[model samples]
Structure formats: C-alpha cells, structure tokens
Target chain A: MDELIINSELHQYKIMIGNRIRYDINTLLPKTYSTILVITDDKVAEKYLSEVMSNLQAENIFTSIIPAGEQSKSFALFEKLHTEALTYGLDRESLIIALGGGVVGDLAGFVAATYMRGIDYIQMPTTILAHDSSVGGKVAINHQLGKNLIGSFYPPKAVLYDIDTLSTLPRSQVRSGYAELIKEGLIADEELFQSILSSDLMSLSQDQLHNHIRSGIKIKAAIVEADEKEKGMRKYLNLGHTLGHALETTLGYGVLTHGEAIGIGLLFSMYVSESVYTIKLPYEPLYRWLLNNNYPLFLEQLHVNDLITLMKTDKKTLNHHIQMVLLKNVGEPVIKEISDEDMSSYLKQFLRKLVIA
Target chain B: MDELIINSELHQYKIMIGNRIRYDINTLLPKTYSTILVITDDKVAEKYLSEVMSNLQAENIFTSIIPAGEQSKSFALFEKLHTEALTYGLDRESLIIALGGGVVGDLAGFVAATYMRGIDYIQMPTTILAHDSSVGGKVAINHQLGKNLIGSFYPPKAVLYDIDTLSTLPRSQVRSGYAELIKEGLIADEELFQSILSSDLMSLSQDQLHNHIRSGIKIKAAIVEADEKEKGMRKYLNLGHTLGHALETTLGYGVLTHGEAIGIGLLFSMYVSESVYTIKLPYEPLYRWLLNNNYPLFLEQLHVNDLITLMKTDKKTLNHHIQMVLLKNVGEPVIKEISDEDMSSYLKQFLRKLVIA
Candidate 1:
C-alpha cells in the first residue's frame, strides 16, 4: 500500500501506487455518489474492466469503452464519452474513473474536466507511461493537426496506479513509460538519473519500477504544485515534450508511443543543451540506449523543414517562437527559445552525433 | 462605457456594457492573443460578425457560426465548434470570443473552457438573456436529458456587452432574458424587485434596460463571488431555477423561452415557500404581471406528475431529493427539500391558485 497525497490548488488527493491497488477500489472511492462512470479504452476494458467492475461495491456504476489508441482522444470520442455519461445520468456528484493508460486518463480526465463544466474523476493508470500523466492535472484530446492540441488542465480527485497492470503492457509501452521516468531523473535528480541509466531497461523487478515511477511522480508533483496552472516551473516537465509532440504530430499521432517519441525529443533537447545552453550533457550513452531499444532517431524519413514547421505550430510555442526545454546539467533544467534556423542546425548536428553514438 | 470588474476565484476581468461597445473591441481585448476565433450563431453572425471582425486590430481573426437557438448547444454542435477551432489553428495563446446569447456563450464558453484545457475567452453578449449567463462563469452545453447537463465553470477573460445588439432581439427573447433578471432581484434585492415590477415589462428605454441588466449582474456577481462553486450562497441565484429547469426540460426545451418557463417556476417556488417555509410572499402582483405578459402559467398542457419527475431528476437535486430554493420574502431566499409527494400537491394547489388569480 504505497499511497502518496498530491496537494493541488484545485484540490488535494491521494495517488495510491501498489501491485494490487485496484482491489481496494471499494474503500478507495467515496462512500456516496449518485453514479460512477468508468471510462476506459477497448484494450484496457477487455483486459481489466470486469475486474474493476467486480471490485466496485457501489450501484449505478457504468463503463464506457473507447477504441484503443490516440484516436480515442479525438473530439468525436470525447463527445461519445459525454453522451455515455449523460445516458448514465452521471451528475456533479457522480465520479468518473479513468481506467487505463495515458489515452484513457487524458481523454477521460478531459471529459470529466468539461462534463457539466467539471466533475470529480479518479485515475486508475494501467500503464507505466501514465505514471507521469496520472500525477499532473494536464489532460487533453488531440486535433488532426497536433497531439494534445485540444484539452484542459483539470486534475483528477486521485490517481490509483497499479503496477500489476503493467505486467501485461508491451515492451514498447514499458519503454514509452521510461521516457518520462528518465525525464524526471534528468531534469531534477542526478542520483536517480545514474541509477536509472545503470538499471536494466529490458527487464526490471516490480520494486524498481515502483521506485522509478514514484520518483518521477514526486518530481512532477512538486513542479505541478509550484505552478499548477503552468505559469512557471511546470515547463520543466515538458523537458522533451516540445519536439516530442512535434515529432509525434509530424509522424502522425500514435505512430510512436508517447514515451518513445519523447525519448528522441529528450535526446534532441540534451543535444541542444550542449550547444545552445553550453551545458555538457553526456548525450552518447542516452542516445545509444534509445538506439539499442530500436527507437527511430533517423531523420531521413522525417524532413527537418517539415518537423520545424510542426514545432513552430506547437501549442507550447507562444509568440510563434519554439521554447524547448534544455538541461543545464543532470539536476538543472532550463527553457530556451530556439529559433527555427538554429533548431535545424542543431537537428543536423544532433542526428550526426546520434549516428556516431 | 459602463465598465465593472468581477473578482472570482477562477479569474477576474471587466464586464463592459454599452451600446455599440464592440467598436472598442481592439483596445478592449488583450494585445497578446495570437489569434481570435469569434464563435457566434447564424443570427448574430448575420447581424454583427463583420462588425466584430473588422473591429479586431489583430490580423489573425476567424469566425465560426452555428445555427441560432438552444439546438446549437448540442453535443454535435459543440464537437463541430471544436473542429472549426482546430481548423482555424487556434492555440493556447489564441482567444475565443463568444458573440451571441447564452447559447453561444454556454456552447462557446464550454468549448473555450476545454479547448486546449481552456484559453482566454471573452463574452461578447448580444442578447438580454445573456446578461445573466454572461456574468457568471457557469458555462455549459446541453444533453438530450437536460439543459446545461454537460459544461464547466470556466469564466471568460472579460465580458463585452453591447446593448445595441439587444435592440434587434425579438420581444420573446427580451422577455426570456427577464427571467434571470427578475430572479436576481427576487432572490437578493427588494428594491430592485419593486422597481422591476413597477416598470413596464414590455417597454423600457435602452438606459433603463442597461440599469436592470447591470443591477441583475451585480446581484448575480455578488452571489457568484460568495459561492463560485455553488457550495452555499450561490444556490440563492437558482431561486426560480429548480422548478424552472424542470419546467423547461419537461416542456421540451425551446418550446417555452427560458424566462417563460422560469416565470411559472418562480410562481410555483413562491407557492412552495408559502406552504413549506410559511413565508409571506407577495404572489398576486407577480402572478398578475405574468398574466399581463402572457407567460403561460396555465397548467392545462403540463402534467403535475411529469413535472415532479423532471424536478426529481434535475441536476440541482441530490440523492433523488428535490431541494427547491424558496424565498422567505424578497431578498430572503432559503433552499428547502421538497419530497415528490409534496411538490405534486403544491403543483396542483399552485395551478388552482393561478387560475383563481
């Protein structure tokens, strides 16, 4: 029973992380609610919906299953969830349980965020990648042009991350989750970073996964607490997300798992840091890890000009300037505004370095 | 220009009111927005879209128009607006200008509320009914089961109310807008109630209309400030709304204007107060006024049982208990839980009294 409390400006809630946390769903939930609508994707619903439902002690509990993937976070799918909630007569007092990975959490959290203006929702993250998303209140859907292009910063009432659910995740997904895990270590904790870099990426015990996820969440939670509305410190969490989102969007969403796309973005950011910020980040080892994991870091398939256009159009870029997060060192993250010309030059250099590494 | 500032937990900004105030849209809006997406309806677009667009000093401005009426607040329409917004490339730095009545405000506000998790939205109210809807941060879209069934509490960055727009509104709409206006007075201000009752319901000068709207907004603003989340005193603003929403929903939305339905509901709530709270409510003048204005207080078309059922299912009700807000007198409101049986009896008695009055 590894439970941590998240204190946010909107509301403070518990993030229960353990192997079998979903078993305590009855006690974890509020004693009273008009209805409960559990929103999950097809993949998660097929695997764990019945188990979640069977564990629920309350009445008027309904499940809405969206199709599996990033497409589920579309405006249409977001609308479908609202229709389901309306059908269930889920009122303000009703609870929305987002029971899946990042897609389910982001999509369902968004539905809860705007359904009747906002309602209470809990996150039951079933993927390691959701360890980052489950903690931060930032939830959104995607537009055809961009990933997470449409959404809100509505936080969940609590996050219940069960490591047991990770057992069924594909190796790519575990790697995807590691993107954020490593992000936490890179921007905030040197010891955590070195420990994570030394650990086995292909296989790890549940305890290691738990520790990594917890450390990532702690770093994220503190940053979120400092700037819940993303007014300041929250940008550090987007350490790799600037180009990460652009790469994800340019390649078309869901082509690369979020963490994988971000893994490359993280490398690009560190590469930029070495040049733009004059910070000596050991880029070779991290670049090799991504390469060994079969991450497509090669830019031959993706045009630099096209990717730069996507970066300029990124939601994070204000005033049409790309502000990419860079590392001053292992424990120091800085946001630097990179011009397209400079970004293209850096991309050429970074890819050249990636080939050498 | 009559400018007043609203201080709320979400955010605060000025509510600018006057005739042809949209002329100042350039200086009034924040200079930093990358783009502006003006969301209006067919009717408002036909009349004032260009004026708003031309008034914009910013180069990147776009407009989206839905059909005019409550129908535009549907899930489908809401999704369409998101699509339009996505098509427009509206980003986090962009602004959403809701330029119509409450439908546009609610629908567009709900869209902006969730668009990229919310960007700054400015309420450019073109209807009198919007005087109530515009001021409060309560924005929503309707479900088939209920009005405002899906929405959130995202306040606009500012409200720009042009009284000139109200001049073109149909008499029915002006009357519809009065429901919330009268509600504000009835719940909070004895003097305002007396003055409104003394004035010609159908005829008023533009200045007089502005004063009533401003006064109504002031009362609503005070309540909203006290209970932004509607946890306590803000429920007072729903004085006529409990049965009002039920009556509106039961009547088939759009059949009766929001005010006409709430007029009947207000009469019913007063009757309930007389019985349940033993409050001395001056019911005759208001009932006579309703008759004079052709507000359908006639219960011949409505079934008491159906209305009761609707009330029981109202979003305001909790745990199947229909708690109706009752007034002890003008400026003294109380929320009293009315059982199904009692509400039905009161409906029967209230109709009998309306017929006699």
Candidate 2:
C-alpha cells in the first residue's frame, strides 16, 4: 500500500502511514548519525523489535528495552536510558528510534531531545492507540503530579506507521484508538465521524483501517501545520483533551487508556456545546454510539469535585479559569471560556445525566 | 568598562558581556515571548536573584528555583523545571531566563529547549567563572556515572554578562575561573598565556578582569560559531574536559570544583603534549603559579588507575580510543588519537612526578 502522508507545514515534515514500512527505516533516517539506538518497551520489543532491526543489517543498531508501562516514563527510566545509551557508546552522531507507543515515544523522544542538546529520532508506533498520539510531534511523559507534565516539541525526522503491527492489538485498544479518530472528526471532519459511526468499525479490512487512520492523521496534521506550537489553531486539537487529561490525571493514568478518558470527556463537551453553541448535534445518537463502542459516558464513580479540582490544575487553565473546547456540533469545535460557576453546574447536573436507550 | 561583544557564528547569537547588565534585561529579551520564566538555583536566588527579578519587572515574569547543587541537575530536576514552567502558565509564547552559572544555564537551557520542543532562553551568568562556561551555549547536567552525560546544544537567545556580580565571588572561585583564561591562552593565543603568566592574577583591576574575560569568551565564541554542535573544531574546547570531567566524576563532585579538576587535567595534558609534540612549554613555571594560587591538584592520595578507567568512559573516547587535545606548543593544539599503551604509562610515571612537584 502507498504511504498516506500527513504534512505538518510549520515544521516541514511528513508523517507517512502504511503497512510493513518498518522494514525501510533507513529511507527516513538522516545519514549524519554514525550509530542508531532503538528505544522500546519490553512488550513491544518482545513482539516486533527483530522485524524493525532486520532493516538495518549494515548499520550499528543498539536496543534498550524498558519494562512496558506508563510508569516506565519516569526519572529512573530516563536515567537508565541515559546510562545504557552511553554504555553502548551512543553519541551526538547517533539516531534514537522510538519503537513503541506513546510512553516509549515520549520517553525516547525526550531522551533523544536532551541526549546531546538533541539528536534525530524516528517514530515507529506499534500500538493501534498510538495512531493519534504518534503524530503532531508532541513528545512528553507523565509527572508525579500530572500526565505529560514534562516534554518537548522535538519533531521526529519522520514517522513510520506500520499497520501490520496493529494486528496484534487487543480489542480494548482498538476501541480506545477509535476515540481519537472520533476526536479528529469532531474537531474538523464531520463527514469522517459519520462514516466511522455508520460503518462496522470492528470488522474493518486492512485498507479500511489504513484509510481511517490516515484521515484522522490528516485532520490532526492540518491543525498542527497551521499552528505547530499550539499558539492558535492547534489548541482546537485539544477538543476533548483539556477535560480528558484532567480526568486521566485525577483517576490516575494507566488505569484508563488515554482515548477512553477522552471518550467520556468528549460526551461532557457535547452537553456544553449543545447549551452554549448554535450548532445542533445528534446528542442521543452520539451517546448511543459511544455506548455501543464501550465508552463510559457517565463517570459517576469518579468524584465530581475532584474532577473539577483536577481541571483547575490543567495546563490549559489560565488564571484558574477553565478554557474548554466546546463543539458547535459534531464537526466543528469552538473554544469556550467557561466561568467556574457555569462549568460546575454543567458537569454536575447535565454531564452526569445520561440518555439510556 | 565597555561591554564585550562576541558573535557566535555557529548558533548565530551575539553575546554581550558587561558589569551589572542585569539592570537591562528587558532590552535583551526577545519580543517573541509574551512572558518569561526565570530558572535559578537556591544559592543563586539568595545571592543575586533579587536583582535579576527587579530587572525583569514585567508582570508576566515568573521565577522557579531548584536546590543549589550539582545534585539538583538530574533527570528529576529537568522534569521539575518542565512541570514548573507549565505550572507557571508558560506556553509557546514564554521565555526562560537562566540566572546562574553553568548548572542553572544547562538545566534551564535543556528545559527551554525541550519544553514543548524548544523555547527561547537568556543566560544571565553571575559568576566570574561563567565567562567561559556561559558562552557557546553548551547546556548540560551530570548523570550518575559522569558529568554532562545528558544535555542538549540549544543556544540561548542572548547572554548578558554583568561583571559587577563577580565582586561577590569567593576567592577560590576567582582562581578557579582563571583556569579557562589560561586554557584559552595555551591552546589558541600565546600572547594571552604570557600576559596571564606575567601578571599577578590574584588582584585584577576591573578593566583587567573584563579584558581577560572578553578575550576568553571571544575565543570560545569563534570556535562555537564555526562548529556549533562540536562536529570538528569545537572538540578543541574539550582540551582539559576529557580527563577533567573524569577526575571530577571519579573523585566525586563537590570535592573538587570543575575548574580545579580541569586545572590538574590541563597540567596532565601539558605532560602528554610534551611527549607527543616538539612545542616548547614552560610547564614547571605554570605549575608553580597554579600552586601559588592555592589550586588543588589531586596527587599522591588519589589512585592513578581509577582516573584512567574513568577517562576511558569519557565522551571524547571513541571505540575505546581516547582522543585528546594536546598542545603542539604554547598557543597551538593538536588533537591526537591516543593509544591505551601510552595512556597507561603517561598517568603512572609522568603524572606521578608532576604531582610530587
């Protein structure tokens, strides 16, 4: 299959999506690096690293695998990666390949970024959920206090998406990954959302899955290209992320996959959007679709006040004011500067209420 | 004294050195940033931070201070700076000002470079020793096994050197700072070496100190401008650093300041240079001068084999081959590819004699 391209205009890089492209990593690696360090998690490495390694038969490749988990993206992990990289004799002329999902990407990108001021890195995302997280070059790791509290805007040399790897993804991850696709559509492509909602998502053929991932990536690409540093238009990409990140942080990460929290947060935004905007959304149908896909819309088990407190601590908050991305409808998002008073009522009374079919 | 101007061609930044320029920080701050975060150490905060804060009087100026030590410049510290920058409401529109010596500069520069990919930073170096450390924009921190194991080559927007702060420097620090001046003269400027050797460095007139600092900075700036990422010419700057950093790592930091370690390392290099090159050097005179100045050169009590083992792990080593910058003679340096055979004997026999001197 031909690689689908997501061009980020600001940074001037392309995200290429295809199947089995991990076999051709050198085509993307910059020739300047004398050595290559492949950073991966234990799970991903055990499953697929040898395939990635096979491509660089002539090159010097070093692999450092950490235990697979969000917890691995810690100071201790960063220190280990630094020591191992040095022990393997990696230098400024080395290329660090992040060969797993978001945790690996964030930690590895950070390691590469700060390794010698910075070095080159190629994103070889393995998880189905990494489809959305892998693009836009926002590499970060969770802190003790919050998720993605530490990171950099270090763009990858190129991103290689191998669809073949997604075949190993568990069904739960497939559902989780769909939330970001839903997000991409909600932010800019209403037609894409309709197509996804109307389709038999679980039974998608390889070609169908590739197209869906590409479309979602393209939507994200356009936004990032317009505003690479989240100065303006890129903020729109946080459609469900502001509330979603708060929910993830409050609930504690690793408990819920990122997309799952955003799935719940996406429904909450629908309530805010319906009340505050002119666009009329199919709220009941959308909620039903989320339920059908196994998303928890009413997070009653989570303390409402705690979520509010977590939202206040969000990186998106300015002067303690919650800045929410409220959708005009299914396809359009408008950033609403919601007052704390109105946000609490919106979350407690309306967001908690569910339309059970 | 007039401010010195050194244009770094590699990174393309103009370094401004003067006395009390912290009073004029607003002029140096790039207009691109809407806000600024000042990254400092606790010790520096107690010493010169008030002046730095007062100069950046804008309401958007925020300050975050970490513990004052080399220990604080870890992966954990890097994460804290990243988080605090976010917590202080920093965005892409923000700038980070490093208001201390090498530690603050390295950590803050790494933070700015990695926070959201990269941001702008200004170096307000307060120490007299920072005359050499501040320029070239090589920001880094220590790892467990070594110093500056994790870092980036992210240049600051500008460096404003205020000489007035040097008045507060301890006497030991002033002597330590002059080692770089001697280093500059040894490698590139014969006249600079003679001038330092002839003069009483213990009591320098303000103008004299400024002239020496400016000359050293100009040399660093010229080299950095040519090889910003240390591809070739910048390796010369690591003359003492290879063995020096090893010494510091082996003996443990805090036991010896960076310049003190380098001072002894420089003497060691001189011995190596004498063996490999025909260049004439007054090594005995220089050693006497350093001893008179109360410089601590680790000798009899320290293990020679341990230091050599540490040197093997130095970043300057490639494929187990130690690359060293040896003085061809006064004012000329030749980067030699040293063998392990020569390295072992040079430390045991020659270094033992020098230490007894």
Candidate 3:
C-alpha cells in the first residue's frame, strides 16, 4: 500500500498503510533519532511490540506498556510516561512511538506533546479505530469532566497502520471504527457514501478497506491543512464528536467505544439538522443501519440538559452555544449555533421516535 | 507607560513596562475574553491579585494561588491547575494571567500552553528576575530530575512588567536579577555592558532601571524574533544557561536563585571560551564584581564529573556532546560542542583558579 500524506502548517507527514507494518516502522523513523521509546498498552504490547522491535533490531529502542482501555488516558499515566522517558534517558533528539489503538495513541501522543515541552513522535496504530486519531494532530487525555478535555494540537511525524492487526479486533470494534469513515463520506464525498451504502460493509475486502481509509484520510488531511489548529474547516471533523464526546464523558468512557458513541451522535445530528435546518438527509437509512450493526443508541439513558451542559464546555463551543456541523445532504455540511429550546425539543422528539427503529 | 512590543511568528504581544501595572491589567486584556483565571503564588496573590481583580470587576475572573518558590513548578501543580481550570468553568476563550515571579510565569504559562491544547495567557511578572522568563514565551514546569525538564515553547499573549514589584524584592534578589541584564549586554550589546559596569547597580535611579530592562528586553525580543522555536540564533541567548541549568538541577533548585547560578556559569564560560576559542574577556573584573555583589562561587562543593554528568543531559547537548554558547568578545557569541575531556579539563582548571580570585 502507498502512503497518504498530510501537509499541516508546522509539520508534514505520511500515513503508511499495509499488512504487518510493524516490521518496517523502524525504517520510517527520522534518521537523527537514535533513541526511540515505544509506548503501548499491555494487550498490544503482548501482541505486537516484539514484531515492531524485530525491525528496530539495530536501534536503541525502549518500550513502556500502559494498561489497556480509556482509563489509561489519564494525568497519572501522562506523568508516568515522562518519568519513564527520563529514566530511559530519552533526550530532545529522541522520538516516542505510539503503538496501539486510539487510547494508547492519545495517551502516548500527549506524553510526547508535553514532555520536555514537545518532542518528535510517531503513531504506529494497531487498531481500526486509530485511523482517525492517528492522522490528525489532536492528541489528548481524558479529564474527569470530559474526554479530551486536556490536550494539545500536536501532529505526529508519521502514522504507520498495519491492517493485519484489525483481524485481532472484535467485530464490534471494526464496526465502531467504520463510523468515522461514514462521517468522512457524509461530510465530504457523496460518491463514497453511495458506494459504501450499496455494499455489504460487514465483510469488506482489503481493497474496500483501503479505499475507505484512504478517502477518509484524504478528507481529514484537506480539512486539517486549511485549519490545523481547528479554527474553522477543522470543526467539520467534529461533526459527530460534540454529542459523541458528551456521551463518552457522561456515560463513562469504557462503557462504549468511541465509534459506537459517534455512531449514535451521527444519527442524532441528522435528525437535528432536519428539524432545525430543514436539511433533507438519509436519516432513516443511516439510523436503521446503525441499530442493525449492534450499535446501541442509548438515547433513553441520557437527558437533554446533561448533554447540553457537556456541549457548552466543548472546546468548539463559542460564547456558551454549541456550534454543530449539520449536513443538508451527503457532502454538504454547515456549522450553526443552535438555541437551547431547539436542542431540547429535538432531543425529546428523537427519543420519542426511537421506540420503533 | 507605553507598551514595548515583541513580534513573534504566530503572536506579537506587548511588554507594558511601568511602575504600577496591576491596577490596569484588565484594560490591557482583549475585550473578547469574558473569562479570566489568574495563576499566582500565595505571596504575590496577597500583595497583587486583589488589585488586579479590582480592575476586572466586569469580567468573570478566577484566581488560583500556589505555594511560593520553585517547588510549585511541578507536574502535580500543573495537573492541579488544569483540574482547577475545569472546575472553575473556564472555557477555550478564557485567559490565564500569571501574576508572580518566574516561577508563576513559567508554571502558569505552561498551564495555559497545554490547557485545552493551547489558550491565551498574560504574564504579570512581579519580580525583576521574571523580566527574562516572561518575554521569550518559553514556559515550563520543572521535573524532579531537572529544572524546566517538562515544558513547552508556548509564548504568552502579553508581558506586564511592573517595576514597582522590584521594591518588594530583597537586595540579594535585585543583584541576582542584574546578572541577566549583564548577560543581555555580553551576548548582544557592549554598550549595555559598559553602562552596567560603571554604575552603582544596587541603587539605580528609576529611569536607569527602566532603560536597563528595556535594553535587555530589546536584546531578547530580537533574538526570539529571529528564532522563535530555538532553531538557530536563539541559542546565543543561552550564553551561560548550559552550565547554569545543570548547576540548578544537580545542586537542587532554589538553593541558588537562577541569576546566582547563571552568574557563576557566566564566569566559567568566559574561562572556557578563553582556553578554547582564544576569546579575550574581562574575566578578572567580572569575577570581582560577582563576589562584590554577594554572588556565591560554590566551587568547593561541586565536582567536575557531576557537573559534566548533568551537562550531558542538557537539551543543548547535541549528539552526546555539550553545545555551549562561547563568546569571542562582548557581543560576539558562538555555539560550540566541547568534548568530555575538554569539559573536565576546563572545570578542573577553572576550579583551581577560583582559589586565588
């Protein structure tokens, strides 16, 4: 597989996709860095660390394994990683590699972001969900109040994705990861949406997976290039993330994977868009597909007030109002500040309607 | 009092050099920011925080006070500030004002730098030593292993230097702060050097104090403007800090004020410069002036090997060798990589020579 390149303001890097990429990660690293620290989770470390180290045989590499899951995205872990980096004698010339899913990527990337102010880092994602986080520079850890509440917009030097690792992921994980791919299609490409819609997405061929991820990355790369610091166009990437993050924060992180929450958020966004903006979207089809795929739409568990409260604290919120990205149709997204009455009314309507499908 | 401007790459901010800036800080901030969080030490908060908040009567402002001294510059404090910021309902539009000496400026500025990734911050430095740290936007918290081991290159939105606060400083502090003023002269301007050498530095007129600070800041601003991220010319500004930081880290922080450590480092640098680069400097006069001003030369307690070990871990040590800033003459600085043997030999000779002086 060829590399997909992202040209950001302060950094320019490539996303190299292939099967068993762990063996080639060493070659992708910058020549100046003699010291490499690979930060992964216990699960991923057991499965893939040695594979990555096999290629890094000639390098002075150090590996630190964090506990698996969202709980590891913490201040304590961030501090611990820095201590480990210091203990391993990692210097400014050294590099830190994130070698797991988004949780590991977010934790290790943030550690790299704050360690010695900032240091060079690479992302070698071993999960399907990491495709989105590994591309963008938005590295962060979860605060008690919210997910990604404390973080920096730090871009990675490279993103090495090994598709073979996806085989090890549960079916739910694979389906959840596909939500962002759907978002990229809905927000930017109508043809990509229609193409995926016509297919049996559950059993995607290697070529299908490649095209989906490449297109998703291309959409992400273009948006980030225009607004690397998330000033304007980059807000579109948070299409399903506002309510998605709110759910993640309120419901507890590990209860639902990122893509599952985002899956529900995406459906609700379409409903709200139709209600508020009179934007005609494929809300019925998308909602059906979401439920059929085992993504639990936990609308009954959440309240409008709690979601609204969480939405207010969002980094995207300006002047205490939620700036949501609503689509008129596939490939046509617009940002709007919704009133409280409209948000509350829409949530009531959506929850009332959810009894059937 | 007029605002002296610092033009950086992404941000250009003012250094409001005056006698009483605490009262008028609200007027200096951007009107768009509705939320303000002031990060200060207990000592400074007692003396200055109320006055600052009095002016910010219309804005929803918050204040957090930490214990005084270098210990406050820790990862624990950094994490606590973020938790406090989140608890205080501070959003992305919020501004954090650092109202203390270099400790507050570095610690609080780092909080703002990493909070929600990056946020706006103002530096209200309440000490003479803070003038140097406040200007460059090189904010950081100290690691247990080293001072400023964990930090970033995030610049503050403004530097509010209130010279009246220097009146609260002890004479030792005042003299210690003067070392950086001398360094600004040595690295960039000989005229500033000559002016300082011929004067009663302990009891300067207010106008003399203003001129010295302004000249020092001008020297700093120019260097930072040329190299905001410390890639090239900015290395010169660290004329004495390579050894200076090592001493502060190994000997324990706050044991010697930053200026006191830098003063001794400056003396040793000149000696090494003379030996290696044949740089003609007034080493005798500088040494006498240092001792005359109560700057302790702690030569007997420190060993050459320990200092060399600390220097090896310095951020400036490129490719496992010390990249020190040496001067050919006043205002002529160059970066050099000194060998371990060369470093040990120079330290032994420098320590031996200190016995006579």
- Report the TM-score of candidate 1, chain A only: 0.96
Which candidate comes out best when scored by DockQ? 3
The model with the greater lDDT, 2 or 3, is 3
> What's the chain B TM-score of candidate 1?
0.96
Evaluation by TM-score, superior candidate among 1 and 3 = 3
> All models, DockQ values?
0.57, 0.43, 0.61
lDDT of 2 by residue, A12-60 (tens): 5557777777877767654546678999998998888898888774346
For model 3, residues B178-284, the per-residue Cα lDDT tens digits are 88998999999898887877667677788888888888988988888889878798888888887888888877877888898899889988998898876679888
Per-candidate Cα RMSD to the true structure, in Å, reads 2.8, 3.4, 2.3
Q: Candidate 1 at residue A114, lDDT?
A: 78
What CAPRI grade goes to candidate 2? Answer: acceptable
What is the lDDT for A298 in model 1?
A: 66
Worst 10 residues of 3 chain A by lDDT: A23-32
Candidate 3, residues A257-333: lDDT per residue as tens digits? 88998987888889888887676789887877777777777555677799888887788876677889888778888
iRMSD computed for candidate 2:
3.1
Which has the higher DockQ value, candidate number 1 or candidate number 3? Answer: 3
- The segments of candidate 1 whose C-alpha lies over 4 angstroms from its true place after superposition are A30-34, A277-280, A294-300, A344-357, B1-3, B30-34, B250-252, B277-280, B296-300, B303-309, B348-357
In model 3, how large is the Cα lDDT of residue B284?
A: 81
